[model samples]
Target chain A: MPIHDVNVMILDNDGVLRREGKQLPGVVELYAQLEKRGISNVLLSNNSRVTSDGLVRQMKQFGVKDFCKDQAMTSAEAAASWIRHNPSADRLEDMRVFAVGEEGVFRSLQELGIALANDQWDGQQWSGLPTDVVVGFNTKMDYATTMAPAWNAIHRGSRWIHTNGDVSYRNAAGAMLPANGAQLAYLSTTGKEPAAVVGKPNREMAESALRRMNVTQDQARIAVVGDNLTEDMGLADNLRSAGWNAEGWMVLTGVTTAEDCDDPSVDRVFQDIRQITRALLSR
Target chain B: MPIHDVNVMILDNDGVLRREGKQLPGVVELYAQLEKRGISNVLLSNNSRVTSDGLVRQMKQFGVKDFCKDQAMTSAEAAASWIRHNPSADRLEDMRVFAVGEEGVFRSLQELGIALANDQWDGQQWSGLPTDVVVGFNTKMDYATTMAPAWNAIHRGSRWIHTNGDVSYRNAAGAMLPANGAQLAYLSTTGKEPAAVVGKPNREMAESALRRMNVTQDQARIAVVGDNLTEDMGLADNLRSAGWNAEGWMVLTGVTTAEDCDDPSVDRVFQDIRQITRALLSR
Candidate 1:
């Protein structure tokens, strides 16, 4: 299917719109074209560090107009929704979450009325036991204080959920630094993987993004556009295999280059998000 | 072979003689019996939290007389020695080590004259690059300040070594706490296992213990006595497989009970260290 034929557009935030903290060329134009075509769009990001409000503000700074918080979906938001709506969590009126993350994770959980377990590394009153353990990107986490307790809680039967499984993220210096997946890797040494990972490549975040756009998988020919093939194209492949008419539009703006897009799973390859936008506009 | 035929006896410190900071029954008698039989002994422990000097002092307090620092071997000491004697380390006079550990790790590396990389979690003068990264049991390790740099150094091509692979250790309150192996498990998520592990089940520590005892592996019919099957008996099985006339005498003292000794690797099973001592003295 052509890019213009898609009724819903799911775009990745970091690589597609911005690269290493700067807005990429043609991002604003791409967003404007989507708005002009009346195509429902959701800006999806696996970065659990920033909330949807922060992402909207970031997109506005990039000169993208009319992009509201509702048009944005983050792993943190999806994770919060996943825990709240889960059938297993229905047993409790309020779920006690032992969280290891920054403000985005805390805010998202609070917005959903989930009680945060007050078990911190700082010597103080310890909350009795957590009902669930949620791990995100926490820069202030220490192994002795923060992680030890979380590991103990998980061993003691708390459900474990990680926001995303991206092992490394690019820092301001453009160097890849260890991310949430690295922490999860460390925690998994206790002999169990997380019960759920609410992020890209794992259908939950994609489904949430699609749902937020008021588009059903069957009702729309969706185009998942992003730079990284594993997270972006993998999600498209997964959705297609699940009977959705979805296609992955690989771009050479961030991690993957044109040479790496030879995988048959990628439906189309573009020089960047701008090229895809130009193609759709030309049509 | 009977227990009396063993010329050298290697004992595990915890569970075999002490448990949860308390001395076990017949520990002093067991040491005395080894001394009387003219068997050279070394107390091996995976605890990297304490130095060899500290372990010697602890043994003296437990009423085990004549237990000197030379008769004690820890993962810390083994790790330091492993780095020093390694063929890859021959080029560097003093290797810049990125150490994530406590007093034991520091003291062991200092004693061996290994230079520590100046890179810390706090803003300080950064060391250019580390030749090696060493991890021991650190109670105060946090992700931001300590682990981040270690992770960075490993990605930058530093050889990684861990003290042991035990996931957790019993704290003073008998609660299981994350150990060095747990930290290693976390770090390993970055897609590389440690190049070398210098603790139990690895022949480096056992070889170091044997060297300190002034006995060659060929000169002795060695008996490794411990309560844990994986660490203690596994070490004996490893040595025996490597052509050493070695036996694993499993003691139902700490982690493992009699039911766990059904494995063919375990040569003998005794109720505790006292029972093995009695059987040896009777011969």
Candidate 2:
């Protein structure tokens, strides 16, 4: 079915607009075209390694002048907002978060008033320090290093949380290898799962993005466009399944391909956002 | 890339072939066809839940008729052989084995003439009573259950041995979930891994299966087929990575699918053994 839509488009940042830290061929041109038509578009992405401020700055380096930091929303900021709103949750200050993660995760906890501790071990004698929340998203972690805190936490009734359940990451070598989330799973000693995950495919981030856009599910008339089924297309599919006025739109550039477009979960497929924007304009 | 010459086939009995006492589709039919092809196919599975004889009998109900007692070797049997063959290892006839598994595992020890004790309250309580090796697989397992004999054995410097490191089982809903291997990993809580693990993906199982076939690696051609990339493909890829003559084959009916075929480790893709056998014959 043709998506008869207006007003909102959720654009993926990495592949649709940028490639290898640089803007792609049609990114600037497409954005200018969208701006000329006065269509509402926001760069909604799952990457948490960088803050939205950092993303906006990087996008500016590519001759894109129209976009600003407020327009770019990342999963980390949404995670902080999620924690803030969930009042019955484990108090951020009281909980000891064992963060085996990146700078963005650190910044997220700081915003939530959640205290975090990274590798103090650094060859020090290992101690049974209680980690109240064992957050998974660490790149430089090993079995013992990751387990030391989780072992303390689960036994102590501390919660476990994963950043996102992304199983693999792309490298300079062009190999899609096991990501930190899967590695965290291997080191989980107590068979406990993350108390909460605040990333793509999770409703927290999507709901936060929609709220920030100042549009209700019925009034927004939104379309989610991305590459992966589980993370991207599945997000919209899940929203639709849950009775949201949203539909999954997929692209073939990254994690999911043109082949996965055939899956019934996906509402529409596009070669790129430029084509999608044009199609939406006609609709 | 197209593959050539499938001389040997290894099968996973659980989930991939038979799941929770029920045989999956085309299992017996595939078995009869492979048996007619004269392929050196062995069921190299990781189901320590039952003994090899019991498993063979279960397979019989599913229409498998060629399995003999000797041919249906369990990891326990391999562990027994390893102990008997090692000069530094405990002598089978004179040894005391503390078992943490079912009747089949204990029966193997009893039939092999190893001493058995009803160890309770830490094998240490029965310490002076004679304990040689502590064997772990799966019983109606509990913390108190393992702690007693396990602690006693660990304290006495009694050797530790485990069957396979399979972390989970498939649910009735077809979800691949975690299993007892996570508990065995906790035996490190008592300090030390089993002296050896015996089944698929383990070099010992590969070596033993190859030894029983009486063929050198160069002379032996092998194709390993399974549904799980982590377990089945892991078995094949691990063998090949260790320089064994094996090609990692994938079947969609079990765990992985053609959708995730972009993964580099999958060497051959087949719907089932029937198609693979037909292709082999034609080739």
| DockQ, 0 to 1 scale, candidate 1 | 0.56
Which candidate has the top score in lDDT? 1
Stretches of model 1 off by over 4 angstroms after superposition: A87-91, A120-127, B87-90, B120-127
For each predicted model, how many residue pairs clash, with residues at least 3 apart or on different chains? Answer: 3, 13
Model number with the top TM-score: 1
TM-score of candidate 2's A chain against the true A chain: 0.84
What's the C-alpha lDDT at position B10 in model 2?
Answer: 76
Expressed as tens digits, the lDDT of each residue in B109-172 for candidate 2 is 6666666655533322453434445454553543334433453454456666666676655445
Determine which window of 10 residues in candidate 2 chain B has minimal summed lDDT. B120-129
